[model samples]
Target: MDLMARVTAVVGGVMVMLQRVGAPRTQAVGTKPVIPSARKQGIMTLKMPTAKGWASGQLPKTAPGLKVNAFASGLDHPRWIEVLPNGDVLVAEAKEQPNPPKTLMDRATQATMRRARAIGVSANRISLWRDADGDGVAERREVFLEGQNQPFGMALVNGTFYVGNTDGIVAFPYEEGETRLNGPGRKLVEFKPGGHWTRSLIVSPDQSKLYAGVGSLSNIGDQGMQAEEGRAAIWELDLASGAARIFASGLRNPVGMAWEPVTGALWTVVNERDGLGDETPPDYLTSVEEDGFYGWPYCYWGGTVDDRVAQDPQMVSRAITPDYALGGHTASLGLCWMPAGTLPGFSEGMVIGQHGSWNRSVLSGYRLIFVPFENGRPAGPPQDILWGFLSEDEKFSYGRPVGVAIGPDKASLLMADDVGNVIWRITGV
Candidate 1:
């Protein structure tokens, strides 16, 4: 096998070991260190390379004790992936296109449907898989649910599976052997969709609140703040009462989120406002304080006023700048904190998946990164943990990694790729 294939095999092996151990659902929330003088330098940043689609056989040089692997393949737009208590991976595949325009029915409409049939979508469902051994191929594949309209993010809390889409939130009874959703599921809540309608979800550590990340309906529009009634904010939903309220506002488009175990702070990976040429307002990973305004149209990173939307003097005073800016157009998504017992360098750190960029003339991201932490917070720049998925040509990428979760064995990493429809495992040498 080639070098990349070899790495993939090694990573896959580690995953199999984790699966054998029965991936635990015991979360590490509110375990952050209580340090008084931990400094936030805001100086270090990642030097990103332009992305190109590399073949599956190539590999990057290893970092002392690190090993890479390609575990599984052949998926259709797999978005959020979670490891169940029974060693199976649950994946939400948002198969259909978002907000497709409906053409008035006529002879012309039929003709258009015929022409669009080649490019249109068909399969939309949730999948479950088991990897018996640590190698790449899954031993079992089963469909858990079907007919979901653009299902993106998923959270499994105490045997209850919560799925998020553009329109609303839904929940279903989850068990180890229960594949293919048949019974009537409960609809949690609904929201108005607009310009950007991807709803990413994360359940609070206490399991009392469900924080859903809603993107702005329009790119930039005349509706302005009014169109943003529920847009660009992290809406907090009470799980028991089913009450929905805006949690945080003016985030533009917060895609991925995780609760910091040590500090109990909510951190979100934001895909900032686009259309500033290539690099204007940078994408970010920051603490989502309750009721904190992030300055969507009025201000940007570090209190810089945006020229596109003239800032109202009143809104300016309300918006707080981000904690840390990842980079301009980096497309940062899927963040996870390294547990206290995993690895040497990244024990108390963060791992962010850069899904790569589309708006730029040159491609970027498409790699897994490690953000070092000291005490309980991020201390340095994000390092490339798993690369080589991008090639030298920059035309296409072999994989686009989305969600990331640490394996149960405490030694390997589990990554979900929506574009390639595969899950990867990474281990240390």
Candidate 2:
């Protein structure tokens, strides 16, 4: 190894030691309220488990009364899934866009990315998988769209297919049951490029508006507020005119979003800022309100001041408290609501695919969890539905769950395991 490589190894070893000694307070899960406790920022306790492919005949463990199987195997880093009206599953086989290292920190970030298996050339395509036999596996597959940037979120409205690229939203012409698009798509809107790059897109129930989740350019506006112009919040776009406006602000890294079925409220699962120890401001699930701000750099968990940033009492006061905490550094990403009677013992709730954490000693997330809802809000403790992504020793991971969606029949759940390069299907036993 060269100089930087050797340096990274030494630093990684020290970090692992720190993680072993760090004491994380509080069990970070469930719907119950949690108190925010900020820890002093210093050495980052990096604890990413090494990625290990699944062994032969290996599968994720499911909850009781549920069965797990591979929906589509051998995908090229599938990151997101969109179930079409005709029962076709659209998977974005994308990798992170190339962001060359410019500084020492950037180089270190690149090294971390390598350890997480997050660095690679973009596949720049979407694949369509069809399970005509309902046998929990896709029998037919085709390339639906190709030659695009790093695409993540996808949505179809009024026969117009929308894709969320790292830097913008694009739309393509579509017809029911058609396998592929004939031409490159038109760019709907451009976004600022920086730290967090995944753009998650969802359409309004009335199909009149589009909501795009854009993350911040840097952690806590370290790159200046001007660089964060249209980031760290959700954007509302008019589908007809393409006009867009910021719907909410101060969200650090909002990823997965869904509309609450009973209340029609907009909901999101946010991945909070790290370097706050293990138990300080937890990642959260909350209902998004128009013009509301959830504290990012300055505060967290609704008004708990993060001494790391400049204090603004007024801004802190405006920060809205999240509805439920999903534990600190869980990296909670994918969100989808389970309709009534969709799955036994899991109906009328939200399922979150936690891609897992890399910033804490004790690894959190890395599985699928179900949070029950009552009267249109989170009402009970979270139950793990899919787990065992990590190895028995917890030092390596067989897979990490990302985007999740309910199947067209609404009787099964689909999860994108980026590390495993497989889409897993879960159904009632």
lDDT of each: 0.65, 0.85
Please list all clashing residue pairs in model 2, or write none if there are none.
Answer: none
The 10 consecutive residues of candidate 1 with the worst lDDT sum are 35-44
Task: Give the root-mean-square deviation of each candidate in angstroms.
Answer: 12.4, 1.7
Which portions of model 1 show Cα errors greater than 4 Å? 1-64, 95-122, 133-137
Best of the candidates, TM-score: 2
lDDT by residue (94-199, candidate 1, tens digit) is 6434344453222222232222221136355778877778464467888888877667777878878888867788899877667667664788888765356567
* TM-score, model 2 to reference: 0.96
> What lDDT would candidate 1 get against the real structure?
0.65
- List runs of model 2 lying over 4 Å from the truth: 1-10, 19-22
